[model samples]
Each structure stands twice: as C-alpha cells, then as structure tokens.
Target chain A: MSTLIDILLLSLMGITALAAVRMKSLFGAVMLTGIFSLLSALWFLILDAVDVSFTEAAVGAGISTVLMLGTLSLTKSEEKTSNHSQIIPLFVVFVTGGVLIYGTLDMPDFADPLAPIHTHVAPHYIEKSGAEIGVPNIVTSVLASYRGFDTLGEVTVIFTAGVGVLLLLGIGRRREDGDE
Target chain B: MTHHFILRVITKLLIPLILLFALYVQFHGDFGPGGGFQAGVIIAAALVLYALVFGLNTASAVIKEWVLLVLIPLGVLIYAGVGVASLLLGGNYLDYNVLAHDPVHGQHLGILLVELGVGMTVAAVLTTIFFAFAGRGHRDANGNLLPHSALSDEIRNRKDGQP
Candidate 1:
C-alpha cells in the first residue's frame, strides 16, 4: 500500500519538475519548484523520516519560495531565450544520472536487515542514545549531543551565509542613515 | 498591500499564529520532528509574510534592521560560548556531559542552548537577506527611493476612488 503511494508521489514530483523546467515565466517556475519541494516533503514523510520532511516543508517550500519570488521581482519575470544548444548539457545529465543509478545497484535492498548501514554504528547509537542523552528523540540526541560540533559548524556556516548575503546586497551598514 | 482590506485582515490574524507556531517548534524540537534550523526558517517565513502584506518599512519598524545585525553574531557567540563554558569546566569542546551535576541534565541544557543559538542565527540571517532583496530597486513616482512595491499599490488604490 505504501509502495503505491510512494509511486504516485514520485510520479507527481516528476511532473512538477518537468513543468518547472518547461515554464518560460520565472514566477511559474518558482511556484512549481515550491510544489516540487512540497511533494518531496511528502515523499520523505512516507519514508518515515519525519524530521527531514519537516525541514523540507519549512525551508524548501516556505523560505525558498519567498526568496525566489523576491529574486524574480528584482529581475525579469520571463526567462530570456538562449541561442546556445542544450544538447551537450542534456547528454551530460543523462550520463551522470545513468552512472548514479548504476552505482546504486551495488547497494543492499531497501530495509534489508543485513545492510551495512544497519550493521554499522547506527545500532550502537540507537541502543545507547536513550541511556546516555536521556532524550525521547534520538535524532535530537544524535544531532545536538553526539554531533554537537557538526551542528555548531552548520550554524556557523549559516551565519557566514547571512553575512555574505548582507555583504552582497549592500546592507552591511550599522546605522539607519544609508540608502535602502 | 494596505489597500487590500482582506489581505491585511487575514495577515494580521495569521501572523501571531505563525510566530507562536515557530516558538513551539523551536522549544519542542528535542521531543519532536523540528529543531533550530526548521524553526528558524519558519519564523523567518512568518516575518517575510508580514513584510509582503504590510510593506517592508512597517516590518522593519517592528524589527529594526540593527537588531537583526546584532542578533546574527550574538547567536554564534552564544553557541561558541557554550563550548567555551564546557571547556572551562574541564570538559572537551562542546562536551555537555560535564555541564551539570548529572550528564543527562547537562546534555539537555547544552542542547537547548545550542539549538537556541542556531535558531537565532538562522532567523536573523534569513530576515536580513529578505530585507536586502526587497529593499533594493525601490523607487518613487519620480524615480526616487520609496517603499518598493507598496507605493504602486497605494497609487492603484488612489486610482480606484478610495481614500
């Protein structure tokens, strides 16, 4: 039953992706991309990755859509037609996608008990996180406790990104006496 | 946007709820499917929605740009401060085990503080970026700097025979 739902969701995602690429209006493309994010969030929910799905829904669908619309407003709504051919890029994409699919063929089946991922340190974390972190959500424990440094690094990266945006957009002033 | 009565009313009703939900996600992250990153973006989105409906100047008035600038670095400082505190207490960097009398409680405290830092930085940065993007290219009737698209909306409202 879940597989059928997954298939339906995947097909819809593909349709949205295609629509986004095909649209000439950047606004429509941006909206389609938001829909694509929503579909992918649903896909993540079906995969039982609630945290990932939540992040996708909030960041991907919400913030990114607004950002893209802001970008569209700053520039042209319609995409300019390029004179160059798209054949080489299409060929490269196909080759890269094919290689990725071929690479995945060596991996274990979905949810296999003996999969390397299950047999790895995941089991140790799952078994010990409850006792060690005392948190109901092991994901939080793993992200914030076991991998605290990594999360700090991620936060710093976000901080840097914010600075970068401010720098690029010329909004780095500390006072209110400058141009908007 | 102010000219659109329905949009203004609906946004006024929705903004508080969105902000409340963002706070819930931020605090309840340890127990649920959310954390600082998601909560930060959610809150930023709420602010952006307010900017969209009420105009950027009003939003900026509510949250001064300088405040966001200070918050961007303050959050990083808080996160790093936790690490320094842990180190000073004879633990390694970011080691929450030594933060309190009990390791479990210490971990909880550390996680909450770090997540708060993350949330602060993310929200400040996103809001700042949105401001930059929306602030540019703002023009008045004679090509002077006005409050971006809100000027055009006001003109449209005036044209429609409304005060």
Candidate 2:
C-alpha cells in the first residue's frame, strides 16, 4: 500500500512538472510550478528531511509563487507560441536532468542509516552540538554557528535580491525636483 | 460600499490577535517550527487584509512607505550587527557565544535579535511587494488585477447596482 502511494505521488510530481512547463497561460504555469514545489516538499518530508521540506514549502511554494505572480502582473499572461520548440532550452534541460539522474544513482538510498552523510559530519554535529551549543535543534546551531559564514552569505544574497528588485521597480526613488 | 457592522467588529478584534501571534512566533522559534520569516509573513498578510478591506491609502497611513524603506535595511543591519558584536567580543563572526559573558545566555540573546531582524525584514519586504502589485493601476479582461478581487468586487457591485 505504501509503495502504491509512493508511485502515485511520484507520478503526480512528474505530471505537475510537465504541466508547469507546458501550460500556455503564464498564470496557470506559475500556479502549476507552485504545485510542483509543494509536491517536492512532500517528497522531502517522506524522505525524512523535515527541515528541508519546511524551507522548500515556505520559500518554494509560497514565496516563489508570490514572486511569479508579481512578475506576471507586470507582463503578459499568455506565453507566445513560437514556430520553434526552443531546442536550446530543451537541450539544456535534458542534459542537466540526465547528469542529475546519473549523479543520484551513486547516492545512498533515501533515508539510509549507513549513508556517508549520516556517518560523516552529520553524526559529529548530532553528537556534539548539544554539548557545544546547548541547542536542541542541531540544524539551527549548524546554520547559525558552525556554518555561520555560509548563512551570512545567504543573507547577503537575499539582501542583494531585495536591492535588485528595488532598483528595477524604482519603488522608493526620490524625484529630482523633490516632489511627492 | 459603506461600513458594515459585522466586518468592522471582526477586523477590530482580529488585528491585535494576529500581531500578538506574530510576536509569539518570532520569540518561540527556538523551540518550534516557526520563526521570524513565517511570523513576518503572517503579520504582513494581516496588514494586507486590513488594506484590502479598508483601502490602500488607509493602510499606507498606518504603515508608511518611508517606514518600510527604513525597515528593509534596518533589519539587515540588525542581523549583521549581531555578528559584528560577536566578532568584537573576540570570537569568530556570528559566534553567538560571545554575545554575553555566559555563552548560553549570549546564544539566547543572539537568536532573539536575529529573529527580530528577520521578522521585521520579511514582513516589510512581503508587504512592500504586495503593495507594489496591488497598487499598480492595471486591469485584466475582467477589469481587475486579481481574479479574487474581481469576483468580490463583482458581487459587491451587483449588490449596489453600480454601472
């Protein structure tokens, strides 16, 4: 029964991905992409990466959908049909997907206790984090401390994105005449 | 089109609770599934709801654009400042242990400060994006930027028999 459910979910994810790319209406595509993100989040949860799943659900399904819709509001709703099938993009996607799938074949099975990831840095963090940081959530400790530099970089990236949007929109610009 | 008794009463009751819940989430993130980002979005959503029901102009009065502009950078500075503080205390960057003489207390303080910063930035940025989209004077085929708004307005206009 569980296997059946897994297969169903996987198929649903595939269909959602296809729909997200192939939909003619831009709004429909964006919404379907959100569904794709949601499905991927569920997949992550099933794989026991609860923290990753939460981040995916929030940033992917929530923020990405909102950002896409905002962009859609500023542009056309319907994708223009071209004579060509966009061979370059198709080739790029195919190559990337093939490489990703090939790479996954060498990875340990999902949720494997003996996985290298579980044996290596993770176990050290899991065992020592409590004594070192006194934090129950090791993920938080790792994010804010052991990997503090990376977190700083991530925050900087977010700030940069915010600045990029502000520059592009000119939402808070002052007029040359200083008029409201 | 005018004020309704039920909505006015409900909104008045709900706004405070939403804000309180946001603060709770911001502080409780250390122990739970929520943190600054979620709290910020929830608060922004509540404000957006108020704006939607009242008017953009009215909401802007409560949360001025200038205030939001300041908040964006303020949150980032607050977050980075904590790290700087930690560095100044003779630890690596963002080493919260140096935030106070007692490492545990310092961690707690650091977490709270960063969470507050994250919440403020998230809320401000989300609302800013919402306002940018909603404030744009554009109309689709149904004469609304959003389908949900169009449907609600259609229902309201039909009740009022507006041209």
Candidate 3:
C-alpha cells in the first residue's frame, strides 16, 4: 500500500513538473509549482518525517505559493518568447542532475538504522533526549536544546534576509504617502 | 478583487482561524510535528491572504511595517538573549542544562524561548517580503506606472493573475 502511494505521488509530481515546464502562461506555471510543492509535502508525510512534512507544507506549499504569486503580479502574465537556444541551459541542468544523483549513490538507504548518520549521535538523541530534555517531541529537543547554536545561526540568517529586503524595497510606502 | 464580495467575506471569516492555527502551531510545536519555522510561515500566510482579499493597506495597518522591522531583529535578540542568559547562568553558550535547578525544566524553558524567537523572526520577515513585492506599482503599456491599487484591467485580468 505504501509503495502504491509512493508511485502515485511521484507520478503526480512528474506530471506537475512537466506541466510547469510546458506552460506558456506564467500564471499557470506558478500554480503548477504550488501543486508540486503540495505533492512534495504529502510525499514527506509518507516518509515518516512528520516535522519535515509540516514545514514543507506550510513553507513550501502555503507561503511560497503566495510569494510566487506576488512576484508573478509584478511581471508579464505570458512568458516572453525568446529566440535564444535552450540547449545550453538544458545541458547544464542535465549535468547537474546527473552529478547530484551520482553523489547520492554513495549515501545510505532511507531510514537505514545502521547507516553512519544513524549510528552516530542520533542514537544518543533518541535514547537520552527523553530523560534529559523531557520533551515529547525529540525533534524539538534536538533543534532547540541539543543544537541551539545552529538554530541561532538560522535565526540570524532570517534576520539578515529581512534586513536585506528592507534595504532593497522597504515595507511598502510606509503608510504616509497618502496612497493605499 | 476589492469588490469580490465572496472572497472578502471568506477572508474575514478565515483570517482569525488562520492566525489562531499559526499560534497553535507555534506554541504546540514542542509536543507536535511543527515548530517556529512552520508556524511563522503560517502566520505570514494568513496576513498575505488578508492582503489578497481586502488590501495591503488594511493588512499593513494591522501589522505596521516598522513593527515588523523591529521584530525582525528583536527575535534574533530574544534567541541570542536566551543563550546569553544560559551563559550567565554558568553554562556554555546555548547550554540549557544549567538554566535551572532541574536540567529538564531549563531545557523546556530555553526551547520555548528560542522557538518563540524563531517564530517571530520568520513571521515578520516573510510578511515584509510580501509587502515589498506587492507594494510595488505595476507598469502599464506606454511605459506608464500604475499604482498597485489601480493596476490596469489588462494586467489584473491577465489569465486570472494575482490581484
């Protein structure tokens, strides 16, 4: 049953990807991407990465769809037709994809208990976190307790991104330009 | 879609629920399958939806741009402040074990504070990005700039693009 679901979701994702690529209208393409993200989130759920699935659903499917729509509104609806050849970009993408897959070949299987990553600190986290942190969700304990420094860095990166956007555009017209 | 009555009504009904859900995701994250990052995006998405149905002006009125700017850094401060607090408590940087008489309770307290920080920063930043993008004036034919509130029908109805 799980295998069937995986096949169905993966096929749908492939269809969505193809639709987005073949779509001439940028609006349609953006919507297709949103659908793609939703499918990805569902796939993540099936993989037992519930926390990851939640983040993907909210951030990838929900927020990114809105952001992409905002971006699409700023530009032309129809994708501009270009005489430039697509072969070079296509070749580059293919090469990159091939290299990524090749790199993954050396990695452990999905959720392999004996994998180096699992053999490492994960065992400690799974074992000791309950007694040490006392949090029902180990992911939370791991993220906020065991690796608080990394989360601090992530927050700083988010802070920097917001500041950069402020410098570039600023939050709208500051409510004083008399323009709604 | 200012005149979109159904959308307007639906948005009015949905915004509170969305916001409540965001908060739930934020506070309930420690026990559930969510956290600051997910919750933050959910909160921003609620405001974005409001802006979409009602208008950016109304949405910004609810959450002023300056407030977001202040929160952007304030969240980082809150997160780092916890670390500093832990440090002052005679633990290493971000070390929660020494935060209280009991290490587990300290972990709980530290995790909540830091997650709050993360949620705040993520929510503010995403909303600011939405405001920046949607706040820009749309360009029309003949190289004339049309204010966002008055985007030309041609662009507004372009295969039902975002309004």
Chain A only TM-scores, each candidate in turn: 0.92, 0.84, 0.87
- Per-residue accuracy of model 1 over A1-180 as CA lDDT, tens digit each: 977888899999999999999999999999999999999999998888998998899888988898989988888899988889999999999999999999999989976889998888899889999889888788888988899889989988988888888777656353233233
Q: Please report, as a residue range, the 10-residue window in candidate 2 chain A with the lowest summed lDDT.
A: A171-180
TM-score of each: 0.90, 0.78, 0.86
Using lDDT as the measure, which candidate wins? Answer: 1
| Superior candidate under DockQ, 2 versus 3 | 3
- The digit string of per-residue lDDT tens for model 2 on A16-83 reads 98988888999999999989889888987887666577667766777667777877877789998889
Off by over 4 Å in 2: A1-3, A51-55, A85-92, A174-180, B2-21, B48-55, B136-163
lDDT of each: 0.86, 0.74, 0.83
Clashes of each: 0, 0, 0
Question: Pairs clashing in candidate 3?
Answer: none
List residue ranges in candidate 3 displaced over 4 A: A99-105, A172-180, B138-163
Candidate 3, residue A165: lDDT: 74
Cα misplacement distance, residue A46 of candidate 3 (Å): 0.6
Task: Report the lDDT tens digits of candidate 2 across residue range B47-115.
Answer: 876876776667777888778878877888888998899888998788898888788878878877876
Question: What is the DockQ for all candidates, taken in turn?
Answer: 0.44, 0.19, 0.44
